[model samples]
Target: MSGCHDCADCPAAKFPPPPAKAAHVIAIVGPPNSGKSTLFNRLTGLHQKVANFPGVTVEHHVGRLRADTDREVLLVDLPGVYSLLPHSEDERVTHDVLTGLRPGMEPEAVLLILDCTNLGRHLLLAAPILNLKLPTLVILNMADDLRNRGGQVDVAKLSAELGAPVALISASSGEGVDKVYQFIQGTAAGRAKVKAPLIQLPVLQDIPKCRRWASEVGAGAAYRAPEPPRWTRRLDAVFLHPWAGPLIFLAVVILVFQSIFAWATPVMDGMKTLVEASGAWVAPHIPTPLLRSLVVDGVWSGVGSVLVFLPQILLLFFFIGILEDSGYLARAALIADRTMRKFGLQGKSFIPLLSAYACAVPAVMSARTIENKRDRIATIMIAPLMTCSARLPVYTLIIAAFLPNRPLLGPILGTQAAALLGLYVLGFLAAVLTARLLKSSILKSGGTPFVLEMPPYRWPTLRSISLRLVDRARVFLRKAGTVILVVALLLWVAAHLPLQNGKPPEIGQSFAGQIGHAMEPVIKPLGFDWKIGIGLLTSLAARETIVATLGTIYGMEGEAASHGLQQALHADLTPGGALALLIFFAFAMQCMSTLAIVRRETGGWRWPAAQFAYMGLLAYAGAFLANQLAGGAVTRLIAFLQ
Candidate 1:
């Protein structure tokens, strides 16, 4: 009866067994930039899932820990709170969860993370938490920072005064982490309890007596006359300069994007070739045409489409990680705050908007950092306009095939690269316009004042960066994997069905072709053919799937251009057609995964459905105009030349 039971039915016995000790729910709480997330990551590794607390937009990260021989604990990384009194949705969720007032959950232990150097201010939240009487532990994180500053904490003495154990842990370096884990298990299992001095409470505020205890315990832990690092001061001068900071940030962003394209070209080419070779290798071995098409056209093309963007995505994250680690991101946020306020957005929304350029999934998720509901929703709505990497293949292919390589402003930049840059600018402008429009009309609200904590610059650890890269890649592959696989197979079937007189049917006669033909008139004015129409249809599965859809529809085996696929497309598609296709891809709601996530985030299908409808209309209208303009221009130029 005392042991854990796997079954639901307890033999209808005389006495109900005492409830097994409830598993301890430890909440990790601290201020922003206090290494709380880092500690959570180190403890949980990859065993964490992100979800929103019920009825709230705030994200909740939950992970399990095997603390001791037989004890399992659930660790919750609560949103960083500056105080116990909630000022934002994130803080409210944290507060509710801690007080057991959330819809249906309660934490049994609170792990208050305090920065060793800033303990005076960080202990404000800890004082209130101790009053909850939920068995607390004080984790003096960044202990190494104290030592670096010519200071040290007397942990044993600190524990004696605080009425609880104090562990001097360096979350980043894993110093003293095991001891903290051991203490958690020991306390949860009731094997040992430290009875240190308690801070007497004043009946009014329910303040715990632990303040005095902590003060006594931490008396020698305090130090004075710590020298500031010269390099940090020098770096901050240039990085946080009011006049030149914004300009430098912009230049850095442009350089990163340029590098993404330039550096990833060779790797992307190699992937394309590999995919093609893989298709060829598997083709002869597969017996059925259906199976062959499924493997070569569906699976290879779909996976390849996702892989092509890997380089750009990784590059974006690389720069993001560096900026985040170097503490430049917070400064950037500060610089952008005034500008963002005009559009009813917080400065924190800037990163998410920037990230949307790579993909909207992370961008939308990143919106959690934006505290206000209005800002978060407005940010989400405009995220798709940020030119995600899924649109890159379409943009590059069109530019290569139709746009001349000649430079517009002399020889410094190619016309194609210029156009690519224009597209990025266009996406940014569209997002800005859309956000403003939404704010003024549908989601009007005051912007949240930005008060971001700017941490000191630090050398980014390779281990952390590597882990983030792997985590992002794994997430991308997983989300795009199954959906891509099924869609690919369906596309192949659509493009290769109904053999006619022992001859493999031409695309025009295949199922996809017929469907495209049926919708031709609807899109004909925009210069798209039935094949392009079919590609657009399959794109609903995922925006990147458009490339694979085209590959399959063109009777190509894999992700790469076949012997004549590009040439054939160029010959068949007028300049207007290319422009129209590019415009469509730029604006269309083509990612199903994005829609699903939006639904989950917004708590209903209403917003997502509206998003799809409005975006679809915008795509069609934009593409129509682009086609007319580009087609007329091409015709006039050709005539003049003749």
Candidate 2:
């Protein structure tokens, strides 16, 4: 039952009964970041099942891969782990399933996904699989990436050393997949357990021997690496340089933020024109003012609100996909490690926090990679404090309206971009502080050391990155369609209903307006008016909803110009109030989706509830400071200039 081997004692060896007809279970196992998920996506494409692995929250994906005319291989994508020796939930789940020890689950064969880019370390995991004596096919994923990066893997010798088939395939490009089917068809080898050399000891002393054995097996495959990790080393030289590395990373981050506003401006303006044109064309044609009002103000306004954010969302995800695929994020993580350790996190935390800029739900979920319970929870708790894309619309709305588009420091960076960058930096600082507090107080499993595997660099296909971008857009649009759309509908209904003296209702007299008024006492000290109060209340569901809610709220008041909301925000909000609002959103865990995900990932309500409370207090305090500090400073500067 030991996960280390599929010998005579293994359940897999006994169950199939030497009959080729017996259902052959195939498990895909690997170290983290080896593109196993990418391979799973290719092999199972739209034909997969996702469920919990027995008692744990970790997902188990089961899919069918065709073997031949007679049989279909059941492919289980085991959770990525380092070795058969269990340390975390992922490792435990993977081990139980591979050993056939978990109730009703026994994988008869294994497709060990090894990184050709890092074969030596991968062999540490692969060695134990070979010991299981089960038919093991070592898959060299990212082989193309390795070769392109000036590295090589001797598949022939690797197969010989392990007595198993090895396939070099670029799972990302969908290349060399047929080799897998062909190998499965030849299934004569690997079905019966071989007497793989067994390690003599389970104690700590023998760990080096296992790794040494792995090293020896790897040596035959030239796992010693056929050549110096030339390109990787060169790239690392610049990217991981003590001075250049941090500088380059900061510049890249700034460039990413600048492009979000710069590149997306054209599309955003175009959408505004389209929405205005559509509203203008359709508004005059309707015979009745009531129907016309609903058509123009309710639906179009709601739809238009969400549309404004589309460009930013699409571009943000596109950049993230490129950075992730190019393997530069690993470099970024490395660079961030020292800084992260200061805040009670490590390099491993940087990716999820970076991802939080796009959205916090997946970022919180990504924290599971930390393995340490306290660190994982701390990461989750502060992930929302990162400047997610949802906050982009709100930031832009406030900035574009109030802040002049004048150049800062003589045109290299504009005031708006600088302000935007400052907000991002602010969010990062807040997250660092929050993590420090959590680690020092609530979650004090301090400072666990971890290694980040740097994957080989490749020219990732634009098509693949685009496909991923499209997926992100789909998720955003799905939320827009479901949650934002419903909230918009309700807001519209509340604003238009309860007519005053048989005429159109004044928005201030409507149901939503009353709610906004009730919230005014709480928001007033922060310099926000009742209308801002309404947007704040509505946006509790989704951060981006603030933009749409503001758009809808203004549209209800019959504000119709293309730049109407922007101008309105400029006119309605004092510089202090606007700054306060932006600062508030910078720290607020306002997205219900983020809260729900934290609940699911933590398996309780307590953490999510705590997250909401602590983040709320931070948002309030931060806003109060921004209101007091920025408002007075701006006024004094204005007076001095005058």
- Could you tell me every candidate's TM-score relative to the true structure? 0.81, 0.71
CA lDDT scores, all candidates in order = 0.71, 0.72
Model 1 agreement with the true structure over 443-551: per-residue lDDT tens digits = 8775544467777777887767766777666655655555556766777777777778755578789887899999999989999888888888878867766666677
- Once model 1 is optimally superposed onto the true structure by TM-score, how far is the C-alpha of residue 519 displaced, in angstroms? 1.8
Q: Mind giving the per-residue lDDT tens digits that candidate 2 earns over 489-587? A: 676677677778766676677887888898898888898989998787767767766776677667733334427888878778888888899899998
Best by TM-score: 1
lDDT of 2: 0.72
Top candidate when judged by lDDT against the true structure: 2
Q: In the order shown, what is each candidate's alpha-carbon RMSD?
A: 6.2, 7.7
Clashing pairs in 2: 5-132, 6-132, 357-388
lDDT of 1: 0.71
